[model samples]
Target: MGKVTGFMEYERLEEGYAPVQTRLKHHKEFVIGLKVDDAKVQAARCMDCGTPFCNSGCPVNNIIPDFNDLVYTNQWKNAATVLHSTNNFPEFTGRICPAPCEAACVLNVNDDPVGIKSIEHAIADRAWEEGWIVPQKAALRTGRKVAVVGSGPAGLAAAQQLARAGHDVTVFEKNDRIGGLLRYGIPDFKMEKTHIDRRVAQMEAEGVTFRTGVVVGEWPKGSKITNHAKETVSAEQLKSEFDAVLLAAGSEVSRDLPVPGRDLDGVHYAMEFLPQQNKVNAGDKLKGQTLATGKNVIVIGGGDTGSDCVGTSNRHGAKSVTQFELMPMPPEQENKPLVWPYWPTKLRTSSSHDEGCSREFAIATKEFVGEKGKLTALKTVQIEFRDGKLSEVAGSEKVWPADLVLLAMGFTNPMSQLLQSFGVDADARGNAKAGVDEKTGYKTSVDKVWAAGDVRRGQSLVVWAIREGRQAARAIDLALMGCTTLPR
Candidate 1:
């Protein structure tokens, strides 16, 4: 709880963004975070609600109110301590998380919710600047070894947690660099990869070993899942080598549009387009890097990936950018009373949208129009729901010129070949079927093996991945030591 009557006295403040003209020139973070005084004022707005749904709403279960009060009282050191207690990387969630915790804020019932995210961002940045964050080397080493496949948030979180718990942790990443989804899936404008780099350094200091460019199992052909893997390790090798194993890869099987001209050049998955730009930004020379410069870019899908495409395209000096949404657009604002304390269906406009992009809702891409194996345009039609069934509207079909088409339709599941190589069983949705239960605890059917994050639960938020990773680490520690002190 913050100030007793602060909610009634102060108005909500939001994080600022750089102007489009300046930001479009480069792919770097443009967010202007709250200053110390501003963060204190924002934190003061937190009310002492008897039931704090925000805690439950957060995937990492951050002690939002406690930290808010600490910030309000200018107790930055204690605030950082409280924050780092539950969440391993508040900086990641602070920048990229949608802040479901704010949506579930007690004050959000009627007024603007507390600026929890902005405050978190401020705290994390300040903590880094003040040199308060450092590697926590474990005093005692457990002889147990944990092999975490994938260097995304989930794997990284699990690895860090296990390392802090005094276990030998080695993380495997197929990509040449670490941070799987965060490294490639997200655009630099939204979250600079440096945040990930610092954490990796900290984890390394903590004795966590990260082996990048090491692919576990088989890398599927024609996969857009960013494989710069120079080496390979079989599942059997890991199972025999490590005392325990965690399959924490991201859900990277992009959902394909099975339409005519699907194989046309200049059309690619969002993952493929995003990673190239990231590589380029990092000074990596890509021979045939996909370019949207001077081209009419059509981004299919209105989710975060689509927004990222729009932003990346704009940075590439694209002639035009248009995003398509299959479902009808929701209301501009959610009906709060109807969907309080939960994620609501509402039209979300990311900074990418503000950077110049046209958004079309309730549309379907029927086919890709091409000329000589090169993409030219998209044959699309407006869609409508009738009798609880989707049907295309008549006389609404149109062909839009598109020199570059990016499929941001999202992922279906983790790489099936990789999962199959490990003999992991997937659920109906093609996610590894592992439960977060007291008995099973993220364990797959295989012995001494566990699954967590997107690979097990399908594509989800980074916060969720961190939570699953931490919890699974606790489970594994308990399984290994018979008893554990790690938090769930």
Candidate 2:
């Protein structure tokens, strides 16, 4: 809108990155953000499409065109305002989100999509630099209390929204710090913890209370997931103390590969391996830490979690890294005309893959081979899908050397114990049973109890979690006061 022919005039400019060698040495953010002028130029590329598919394409439904126009017109503060209107944490999504919004851009039909994520990243960074971000304290206290379990993006967003609506909000996290998975599951190399810390500070200033190292319900014994809780508050206590309870406890049960030698000492879930390094980065000394240094690491799973394993292992100076995917390799380029306004199936090479990795596609691991209780190799075979069923190719068996194996397969469900403690019904997929309607959205079978994010929907992106949290908060606020001004 700023420049009529801006899309035709300028080529897409992407965020730069630190060289592989230089970045692998330290766990710090390596993305070089767009400069102010560069961001303005990039923002100018937003075509004045009557219908902005990018808005619907985004999980949180961000007002893309408004922010892009604001940025192009040098209205940095207003751009931040428009951004924060829909997204609570642009910094987080800008850095990690796959940018499905870009895929749906009108210009993407034939040309590169507008650099929306980069512009958003710029707006957020500039907002912080200019001190535009601050606490939005409530005008009056609502004489109600809310207990939000889990401090991940969902919980944090809900707590912040509820607190701003004048309710006393307390967020309980089992981990030693706030930010459930964002603080532990994601490595510091992709996004520093400082972003979470600052947001926590802002929320605290807005009257949201954070209780870390406090588990809201019983944690299963011997669970591989991280839990640093020193205190456990029973569900009865939360129910009796708080007027409303919101469960944003994320999906934590990692899917297991129940193959031979899975009990090997060197085979571990990605959650177990990732959280230790994050703790180490936070200056905590972990005993018997899982390290990939000088070890041949085999990461199973082809999702974001697996890519994360690749990046972290490389940072650990692994001897070599190989990733396995049961699915066949996708096309390097998507058929844009066929899938313009929706997410397309295509090959995605992450920064970690670019760093270094041997990616094997359509490969299935039949067994984990080990000696003396320690994993040593993997017995694998090429697979093909016939009649929608996977079958191993004949004479394609091979044994690959491996010192460590990380199962980066996605999570199966939220911790069942926590949901059971609240007497919440679970869906067929093991998510908390709750509707998304405006009247009964997020409300569980139990009165005064609700669920959102991964607890209600299955494991999803941070942006989706934030959207669910915000909507759940609005639902709770309306249920409490019979009306609410909070955005959905």
Candidate 3:
């Protein structure tokens, strides 16, 4: 840990952001990173808390305190090593993760926690700048092949780990490019795609093959997604080709609001809207592009996806942006004493909210008001929490005009067709049926097949997906070789 008195002396210093006016012009990362000196100062805030709850709080179990101490002492290279020991992609989590570790910080019991995420971002960026991050090529090849479906965080992690374990690894992505949601679902304003590009290079160097624009299963002909691969191989064909199959396909089914006029022309899922912007940012010309210019935008279902829609709409030069959340607004502050070391209920305003958007909570949408076939406005009502239930209050109905609506309520489950094609059993929530038992590890009901991340656990953070993927890699390796050296 850093100096014992460091936490007592230092205050948290966070990364800066570009002005909204300038940043809204394009889709790019706006969070200004900390200088080395500033990052060192922030890292010094890590105290010797005897028990590090931050480690447990992090899904990847990143060696947070070790890296913090390394950064504090100016050991930049070692800091990156410590971070990489647990997390395969600190850069991704550093930028997009909500930092649950901060919520579990010892200092957070009373004061601001250590700037762990900022320190992580600095270490990763510094490692890249100094050329310390090189490919970790396995010394020996096992001649065993692994096929990982989906190129999201989980699949990438599993492929990287399996490759490093000397197993031939190949990632299959249906999209025209790799990096699944990282390249599509997430906006560039949060994390630039270059981070993913560099990692892809590193993985290639480590002997991982990427098959882009080749889908394993047949996607419906009229999918909202147009720019993807034609079906390349059947599920049985992949099983016959590879020694093992890892299903890391994310929860792709977006939950819908089945209210009146749900099929309006202007109403679209968040995935439909977000991915187009990301493609445009990547220099792809989207024919019949969905633009938010000159339209009043309304994003429903309060979550990261909704927030991202708000930010993207603002960048689209929308006339106005509004966000609606069905749940009641949380308290501005959490009661630390009661909820310490656990995620708490509190109001969190993302950088997107700061970009300019009217956020409404405790409101439920009754219907989508539209003219002809396009959405025109939304009929909503104010609600209050009572007896552990939300009830609409009388005489609180209102109408808000809008031209576009983005439904971002979050994903419900994995696609049933894909799961059924493999004959894998699904849990009640529609995720793959897998147990945490050490004996079976991350294996599915189907032999030689495994599931991890969102497909197994439902909607969760990217870091958790990485953790599951890494763990599943180790499990698959052990099952294949009767032993594994890959880190759990």
Candidate 4:
């Protein structure tokens, strides 16, 4: 807990952003982090609640109160230590996470909650600047090896935890670089990829081996998922080589809109559009790049993916950007009394949304209109949720000019072929079948093989992925060494 009277004394102060006009010129992070004194004040807003719900609200279960108290006392180093105790990467969550902890804050019952995320961002960034964040190499090797597929937050967290637990760890990524969604799915404007690069360096120093551009599954036709493997590692090979294998591969198969004109030249998936901009920002040459310059862009889907598309399109000097949501619009603010201690329903306006865009809800795209294989417009209709079913509103049909269309409807499941290749049974929603049971923890049908993160749980946040990775690492360590000291 922070100061006893701090909550009543201090008002909330939020982080700032660069003007859209200046930031639209380039693809880079424009977020203005909180000042040290201001962050301390914000941290002081944390009340001494008898039961801290923020801890449970956080996916990684970060010790929020302890860190907040430490920050209030200006014990910066101790704050960093406490912050990193549970979260493997607070920096990532600070920038990208929707911060459900704030929703669960006791003070949020009546007013703005404590700025936990800004304080976290400050702590992590300060730790790096003060050299508090460095590699902690294990004293002795456990003589156990773990092969983790995918270099996303889950894979990276598992590898780090297992390596620190004295097990040899190797992380494989299909892309030419590490950090799956962090590197490619997210735009640089939100969180620069350098945050991932530095963490990769630290993990390397901690004795974790990273093998990039090594695809783990069978190739999908006409898919953006790349296969750069010089050689493949069969499930049998992995079972024989490593003591245990953790499948941290994320759910990557994007949901598609197979409506007419989907194959139009100007239409593309959000993943395809987002990653190319990231690659270009990293100085990589992208052939046949998708640009929104001087074009009317229509981004389908109202999630974070659609927000990213809007931001990217603005940076591309697009003529206009519009986002569509199938569901009805939510209230501007949540009913806190009814939804307290849980994520509430509310309309979230992201920084990307603030930049520039038209947002429409309760709308459905009937079809994509195009001319000679090139996208020209979209046919849409308004819909209403009635009698537990969505019905099209008569006389609400309309056509909007669209030179580009980006589908950001989220994902359905993990890649099936990869799961089948390992003979792992999939759940009803196509995720790898695994449980949190200690006896059979995170293990699939096959012995010596396990699964975690989105591939096992379903499409989720990076913080959830990190938690799964750490928990899976603990399970694997326990299986290999007869016990594990790592936290679940």
Model number with the top lDDT: 2
All predictions: root-mean-square deviation over Cα? 1.4, 1.2, 1.3, 1.3
lDDT (tens digit, per residue) of candidate 4 on 1-488? 88899999999989998887888888888989999999989988899898999999999999999999999999999999998899999999999999999999999999899999999999999999999999989998988888999889999999999999999999988788899888999999988999999999999999999988776655565445553455555666777888888898889888998888788888898988999999999999988999999999999999999999999999898999999999999999999999998999899999888889999999999899988888899999999988999999999999999999999999999888789878899999999999987877899988888999999999899999999999999999998898889998
Look at candidate 4 and give me any clashing residue pairs.
Answer: none
- The list of candidate 3 runs beyond 4 A from truth reads 218-227
TM-score of each: 0.98, 0.98, 0.98, 0.98
- Structure candidate 1, residue pairs in collision: none
Candidate 1 local distance difference test against the native: 0.92
TM-score for candidate 3, residues paired by index: 0.98
| Candidate 4 positional error at 398, Å | 0.5
By lDDT: ranked, best first: 2, 1, 3, 4
The Cα RMSD in angstroms, rounded to one decimal, for candidate 3 relative to the true structure is: 1.3
lDDT of 2 at 89: 95
Q: Which stretches of candidate 2 lie over 4 Å from their true place?
A: 219-227
Residue-by-residue lDDT tens digits, candidate 3, 1-488: 77689899989998999998999988889999989999888888888999999999999999899998888899999999999999999999989999999999999999999988988999999999999999999999999999999999999999999999999999988888889888899999999999999999999999999998776765566653323555566788888999999999899999999999999989999999999999988889889778888999999988999999999999889999999999989999999999999989999999999988999999999999998998899899999998988899999999999899999999999887778878899999999999866787889999889999999999889999999999999999999899999887
